[model samples]
Target: MATQHPNALTRALAELPGPLPAFGVIHIAIPHTSRFTVVGNHLAQHAELSLVAIGIGVHIQSLPVGSLVGIKALTARFAEGEMRIAAALRELEAHGYLRRAHVRLANGRMATRTVFCNQPGALERAGRVVVAPKVPPAVPEEAPAVPEEPPAPPPAPEPDPVPESHPPVRVPPRTAPKPPRRPLPQPRELTPELRRTASAILADLRSHAKELVLSEDDIEELIPGVAAWLEREVRPDAIRHALTADLPKPPKYPAKIVRHRLTVLLPPPLPGAEELAPAAHRPLVIPLQNCDGCDRAFRSREPGRCRGCRDLAAAA
Candidate 1:
């Protein structure tokens, strides 16, 4: 019978010469002596990229030139769905890690060309340090010698107190202008009641999903958008569904997702709604007519027997 080491992990750990790291990653980096790729800390420690994007980016960087990095190819290679891969590729493209453009081939067929950047902004940094070539100084032309004029007496020194009156104006440092904020989508004006209703709907979203909890400020901010949906004859339940349905698992920045959905999925005003409004409220006018059976004036939609005569005839 073969004997096996029951506590293999414990035995292996005990064999280490030094005590284990306090906690966190212990780099057991082996210098690549053969085929390898170098990843910069910029990509490895990106603040905004998802783990999926970072892994996909590293995998792409490791692949040799001429390797297929298309969305379809990547979907086949990774366990992630097509949407996640596409989103990762988009993230890479947006952050200057990748670029894709269609190009016409020699045979007139269109082909997509992709570019990968290991280090973004390197070109801009290099461009900023360009050295201008030195130019030769021009020779001075000979001029007739003239009698030297006496140097003008130095102007009397200006009084310090007078200068202080016109103190050097310290100009504030200029900064880049912030992009204009997009206005909330309000298809129609909201009544006070509508605003209250909208507020209630937003406040109750947390009941369905804990991740959808919104602060008072968020609820206030989103009220107009929800009210706008309500103004379009959209139901409160529908508004809740639009904001909460298909939410990301364990939503991070749930407010941002809600805001995006509010803007993108906003329904248009019901078509011909304005035109049909007056007709619904219009008074129903029935011209006075003499009943043919009773020969008496009665209010009816058309020339028909009065209700009393119809009832009596039915009884008979």
Candidate 2:
């Protein structure tokens, strides 16, 4: 026994007996540079055809080898050896369906190739021309607007929650503290030298009141004697030697022996002699170098002798 041959509604559709319905599919293989018109002419002359998907640079997932695809009047280029849109038509072809081809052309220029196919149906399987089923006109439906819930039923009248409890507490008021006081200190006493200078200044102010008032300056000059006294006190021996050296002659008295001679040279107060005692006394010996009767500290005719001593020596 021989195996049965497959029915081809798809193959018969590829070779249409008349003009194509407004919509159909096509599948075919085309040369690289062949225009869409060649493919479309082959379709119009042979296969039934209609609408297809369209866009420039559109991409398809799978295809039969050497088949051209059409999107609307545009003939999509085949992927060379791969068939496009065939994956979508595989099951239909398996069940003995027919396919149609159409080529797109405009202004005598080829645009794209197309393929047409029939959906499986009782009329198609029975091998007779059947008109496509007409779709019923669509009816518009109006929806009723729903009323919003009445403000959520006034929040369900919630009861007041119980109050919280805690123990009572107290805080004391604060007061500012005062600063401690420091005692005032006493003044220091003035020194003796400072007191003396202050007294002298006061005396000057009193005495020179008019002058100070006139010029606001109190200038007090040192007395000449005070300066001399200071010089003498500071250099007593120098002053004494200078005075003695400048005198015309040396004194007859030995400064140390004169005091001792004073008593002997004077007599006690006598009745009548008291008045004459001072004058009657041997004229106190004033030492001279001329007088030899006394130490030779003074110059006189009689060395170391006074005037009286010289007279006594002459009488001798």
Candidate 3:
């Protein structure tokens, strides 16, 4: 029979020889949707690695830190791409999945630092009650009551004062003020896939030059991926073009009027050759023929009058 050893975290901590550090909660992500912030305090210096071991231990035990997990498991799972993985972290943070670990440093100052996925299980969900505001009950009106006065009494005496001497007093000067705070560091923005998407959109538009009519279904399907890509990777100009191009222009008039009067007028292109007038005499004569009206056979295209005469008549 095989002997089961304690978890890596427990084993590591057991191996530690001296006093632990005065560190506070070390936030970690719980692998699943259980709402909690896992705290692994490393009392000693190298405990962070132990914490990592603990996290794996807890993860293997199926007790994930829930609060740090906002996305579906499939979306939150680790990928090889740094940008994608970072993007997943950002998404989680934006949606309140994970927060910066506010740990108490040994020097007694509180500092917020980053960790990959801090999830604390039971502690994260403790007593978070949403109390609705209460509406006070109405009071009934009543009649006013009469006021009452009071009486007076006797007075008393005084005491003597002593000769006072002054003692040397000391005053202290104010301490120098601390410096101004700098802005928080901004996390990275987008991933390579997003950039690729944006580039693809621009390429597609340039390649397909036509206004590129898309059906509602197509737009709906493509919009999310495009928007995500633009948000993450594309340059401002390219993103602008990708988003605004081919989108419906704002109404010329008020929206109400535009919506009410809007009509989809997809009229056909101007009629084709078959719709134009047929030749006057079926087999059109090249040389002039007789004009039945004046019994003339002119050797010209129009025949009615010679071509020059016909032109002059029309002009006249």
Among the numbered candidates, top lDDT falls to: 1
lDDT ranking, best first: 1, 3, 2
lDDT of 3 by residue, 124-239 (tens): 46422111111112221222222331111111222222112122121111243444432222214545655455345534542343444444444334444444434543454554
Estimate, for each residue in 21-84, the C-alpha lDDT of model 2 and write its tens digit. Answer: 4543432322222211111122222223221221111122122223333332123353322233
Off by over 4 Å in 1: 1-113, 116-181, 273-316
Name model 3 segments beyond 4 Å from true. 1-79, 113-316
What TM-score would each prediction reach against the true structure?
0.35, 0.14, 0.16
Q: What is the lDDT of residue 297 in candidate 1?
A: 90
lDDT of each: 0.70, 0.31, 0.37
lDDT of 1 at 236: 88
- Cα RMSDs of all predictions? 30.6, 62.1, 34.9
Off by more than 4 A, model 2: 1-81, 96-119, 130-133, 136-316
In lDDT terms, how accurate is model 1? Answer: 0.70
Model 3 lowest lDDT segment of ten: 127-136
Question: How far does residue 127 in candidate 2 sit from its true spot (Å)?
Answer: 3.7
